[model samples]
Target: MSEVQFACSTEETHQVGKPQAPSFTGPFTTEGGLTAITLSSPSEMDQWIGEWIELAQQTEFCNAFYEPTFFQAAVKNLASQEDWQVVLIKEDAEDKLIGFFPFVRGRGPARLSELSLWKSKLSFLTSPLIRSGSEQQVFKLLLKHLRTMQPRVDLVELPMTLAEGRVHQELHRLIRDNLLTTYHYDHYSRAILTEGHDYDELLTENIGRHHFREYRRQLRRMNNLGQVEFRTNEDPEYGECWADWFLELELKSWKGEGGSALKQDPQQEEFFRELVTSRTRAGGVEMLGMFLDGEPVAMLCTLVSQKGCFEYKIAFDQEYKKYSPGMLVQLHKMQRFLESKRSPWVDSCAVPNHPMINRLWSERRSIEHMVVSLGRPWANIVLGAMPLLRSLKRTFRKPKR
Candidate 1:
């Protein structure tokens, strides 16, 4: 731990019972002469985290998973002790913070660890939380520092970063122009939407109006079974209740039976509860539900940050499968987004060519498992095998219907 003071928007706060890292204040110099600090404890920046998130949101490259709340959840429920590290990319000439990157080093494909950005299997759409315009510069310095830094990191592994995002794009460019030792692990597509003038207009332009009309007709028929109603939690007071409803609803679906639902996993459930509770107060979480005669039938959980909204989980009663309650709720949710204009965009984190969301969100955002191996002796082994592994994965995937 190092000792230093930062001129941040919020003064440091120490919360009892909350996890705390030893006070560490060390000045690290980037090869470019930029100042930064790396801390093992996330609590070190608790006071400044809120302001950091606010600033990150202003940039076009904000990632919800890299937010402090997400990191806190990961540290408490997902990661074991000594698995994660927070590196603060300091502002060039000031005591303030410019960017924050939280990375967890783990073994790569070759059973060797050079990759530090691999946190857990839970995080999707991975990327460093770098200052928007400094992605290239920061990595250059960090990679250089890694060569001599106490814990030798061999590579920065970002497995599922959106191809179009500035983080991925800039890093890709670094490989191209700077001759960095980077490798392409895999490339795949996902559904993403860029909100346009009106939701109606976008729907009409994307999914034909006639087809959308048919979905509405199906919903009207579902009304015959019961009084179909769509609802979302807009009040923090009802967050716990809504979360309970969602978890219970999820239990009635295949996910629970298969032991994959959040409630089925104690750690994951706690992670969601703790993180979503905070996000709800910050207006960054939404619990959308569909009801039948006042009874919950289906629900969708969404997490929002300044960057965009991500549809985290969707669940519905299998008894209402014929009514397509889940898909119906999905449409209603999109309609609500259109009406409320709450988010500028939404990411349906579905796999490529998903049966439902892919058709709805016509806009495609490609994502890839990208690895930048350090120029170490064994690094080339991981780099060389990535393309072959990607091909095998593609070959084994179920063919699109």
Candidate 2:
């Protein structure tokens, strides 16, 4: 860790008797010349929205979860209830904003003395927003900045990072260059629909002739009950009401029965609502629904940006589960996605080996949880023993046979 002071002007500095500044500090530049600043509150993010959105628009890796609007909604409705920090990295020469990393320091006894990228259960990807060409430099500065913070942390965990993406590739380079010790866990790939693939080819290759025929057979069965249709809604006028419709329809699914639906929690419900409204107003939301004679039986929410689109959430009316309304709606999304030239791809954001999405989309994006030592002696010791600790844990967890 480098020794860097908290440099500030006389007026900006806290006095013995006067009140302190609003937890904002630093253009803390490292010897490598990248500067970092930490924002203590989400409201402070308002000042950097322009730069933040621009960074998202130009990032080499697309993570809709970290885009400006969705990120703000997450902070306000989900993460605000906890302690967090947002670190901004910039080029020292031109003072251009290049990286955005929001994280929560571990808390409570057995705190683990670590910092984790901030994300709620509702979020999927965990890649930070970094300018397209500056990933390596930005990552170096981010780690250095983190190392200089008070009550020093031992480990840094980046959850759900897109494996082999530019950011991930850069992290590998940094690990070698910095001589950093690192560990990876929960590595798996989820379905994705890349642009330029013919929809017919993609569908046939993934679902197979037997399943493809079965899909048509199921649609025919649905048509027998009512006029079946799949509709994509993008107009802002219906954002709120349609979001409500999605929530209600989701509540009719197994998730609701198991108490895991977004509508099951007040805060999570508000988060989705705000996310829909904000993204809709920015022309960044699209809702897809499978309707039975004009009544929606399945719905999916997609959040869009210049980089790409994310399949954020989905729900289906349990009454229509046998007919596979959920799968049908996904097929519709894939077809529509291929037809549009707006974004390069749509990430399913589904869990690894997801039964439905994996069968529909053959393309996969690997995600992983990575832990790296912060170069502290204690951090090094913990990381060195991690593998053995994990082995012991698994051994103890084994069932007596």
Best-fitting candidate, measured by lDDT? 2
Query: Tens-digit lDDT track for model 1 on 180-231?
Result: 5667667888887766547677777777989778777889888888787788
- Tell me the lDDT of candidate 1: 0.72
Residue 234 displacement in candidate 2 (angstroms): 2.8
User: How many residue pairs of model 1 clash at the backbone?
Assistant: 5
lDDT score of residue 147 within candidate 1: 57
Give the 10-residue window scoring lowest on summed lDDT in candidate 2.
19-28
lDDT by residue for model 2 over 1-401, one digit each (tens)? 45455645334454588633223354364647677877666677776676677778788877788888887888777875655667788765555578888877784113557877888878988888888889888887787777877667778888888887788889889989989988776788888888898877777787788888898899999999989888766578778888898999999999999999989999999999998988888889998899898889999899887778889888999998899888888887888888987889889888777888878878887889888887877677777787888899998996989
Clashing pairs for predicted structure model 1, backbone only? 1-24, 2-24, 2-25, 3-25, 114-155
Q: Give each model a TM-score.
A: 0.84, 0.90
